[model samples]
Target: MNLYKEPLSRFLISYNLCSQRSAKNFVKNNEVVVNGNSIKDAAFLVDTENDTVIVGGKILPQVKHKYIMLNKPEGVVCSTVSDSHKTVYDLLKGNFNETELYKLKCVGRLDNNTSGLLLLSTNGTFVNQLTSPENEVEKTYFVKLRDSITDKKSYVLKAEKGIEIPPENKSPAFISKSAFIKWLSDESLEITITEGKFHEIRRIFSALGNYVVKLKRLKMGDFILDETLNEGEFKFL
Candidate 1:
């Protein structure tokens, strides 16, 4: 964005090619080429919107922003790269190859033990806006409880009355948004929330003297998880 007048080294850094110091070194070493002309000056003016910038031997591909809706499977972390656990990106490895251009990030994360609908995008702005609490983006989840609450109506009433969630690091307990609860069975139901606190659903249930046995996201804003897409499968939107 607005990269035309920026310095060559700054441009490459913004594109995550390397750290600022590393970018300067890359330029100084004559490892960067602009429009087929090799340039060693890190401060060389660039027209990134139009002029091609090449590193090593390949031209940096212009990012064609991608939006993906993945049916995240249980045991998969919602991250681009990880050292221990399997990540959602691993499921999409073969679909796209331009990692430098398209750095897809999950809009919001699902717990590794959780499964279901997850949204990812190459556009950082879109992800920020969609995940912002001010936007009040609603997310729906299907949860299986370890035990029945006996009276679902009471559970709804308690939630509607507002349950106070413990704050981080000894901060004051704050009341989170009241969830819209819909029961499918004695121990299964859907809960919709506009907030994205850490382990929010599990915490909510825990506060109510219950435990979540299984959790799966079903809907987010205007998009619903396609039942046709099996776990770990994804489709572009």
Candidate 2:
């Protein structure tokens, strides 16, 4: 009975039915029907909870959102579909049917080699809120450097002061605020950052003239990775 208004293009994207560019085209071609009426405007609002949407003549069921936490292994990619490697979604095959699983999307992506806490959810708002840079959500990682620590005090100072992201890095230029770094040993440490820059942890060490031997996410905001779950294992939250 309640209305859940969402733009047609965004709904298509959230449903994984089409990419942003294609969604517009799909709508323009009248391939999408909402409540038995062919909708051509991509910006047209539809009720996600109550509207009956059909794409390519197939009904799109409206289902409740689900939240998931996963201990991602090193080899898995953060993608819905991948031709070369296993995706994070593939790990959920045992828990979800095709329709539900396809609706679930990664909250924030972890690179193919980076292992640790990965969040998956069907709630678009939840994913957007967590990943938005403006939210200043804290993400902590356990890092192992390739070399021994020469000066613990200096490393902490540089990281906390905000390391200058290199020009080559695709992430935004500004580091939001100070990061917290705790040295566990000469080669291992824990760093917490509020910004989700691409290869952020790795780049910080690289700017300090070091290499990251390993990196694993430990926490994101209030959601911490469940330590009990083994690599590649996931549980519904």
Candidate 3:
């Protein structure tokens, strides 16, 4: 099988198909066509000649090389653009030229108020490899709690019995074997999750009768937040 490689973000930006932010938004919204089929990820690779590229009713030319990272700060939305609040893109202004920055897309989302390491790239396969459930890449978090954890609670948490079932019920439940928690302080903890679910860490602690006061991701897959990067800063990976 013949394969062609080009960074999806670069392709969209180089063609002047859309702004850097818009191109990413388009891909996430499944507006870009690949081989005549709509594909949602901006990192998707295609055969330049055989694959078709269409954006907002126009065709786009291909280009290459796209990867990025962001030290997300609290209060910023993870989206490409937003009407109500600052988005991750707003922080990148002036850092990259309009042409060079177009098509960059986030690998995963961080809640508006949650902060820390965030990855972006136009390498679809690499993104998938890192986030895939089977890959089970470990994600670490530094969390602060509203209450102190007791030994019993720590035992329970370490036993991985704090997770819930169906994840919506008010009553607490546990996953047979999935997560682990380590206390860093009476009111702080480090959690490692193999599965990424919506508001998972917060929910688990909530079930344990403790509320999460602050949350920050420390690592994802092989990447870690560099000490040199301050909040809202970003780097290429």
Q: In every candidate, how many clashes are there?
A: 0, 0, 1
lDDT of 1 at 211: 93
Q: Number of the top candidate by TM-score? A: 2
| Candidate structures ordered by TM-score, highest first | 2, 1, 3
Ranking the candidates on lDDT from highest down gives: 2, 1, 3
Q: Please give me the total number of clashing residue pairs in predicted model 2.
A: 0
Off by over 4 Å in 2: 1-63, 169-176
- Which tens-of-lDDT digit does each residue in 1-237 have in candidate 1? 221245777677777877877877777875688888989888787765578888888787654456789999998998766888899878988888856324888889998999999988766556776788888889999999999767999889877777988765544567878788999999999999998888888888888889999999999888799999999899988
As a TM-score, model 1 comes out at 0.71
- Expressed as tens digits, the lDDT of each residue in 157-199 for candidate 3 is 5447534533555634445346777778788878888777767
Candidate 1 regions off by >4 Å? 1-63, 98-102, 167-172
lDDT string, candidate 2, 63-157, tens digits: 55688999999989998888889998888897778998888889889998899999987767678778888888889999999999868999888
lDDT of each: 0.82, 0.84, 0.72
Worst ten in a row by lDDT for model 1: 1-10
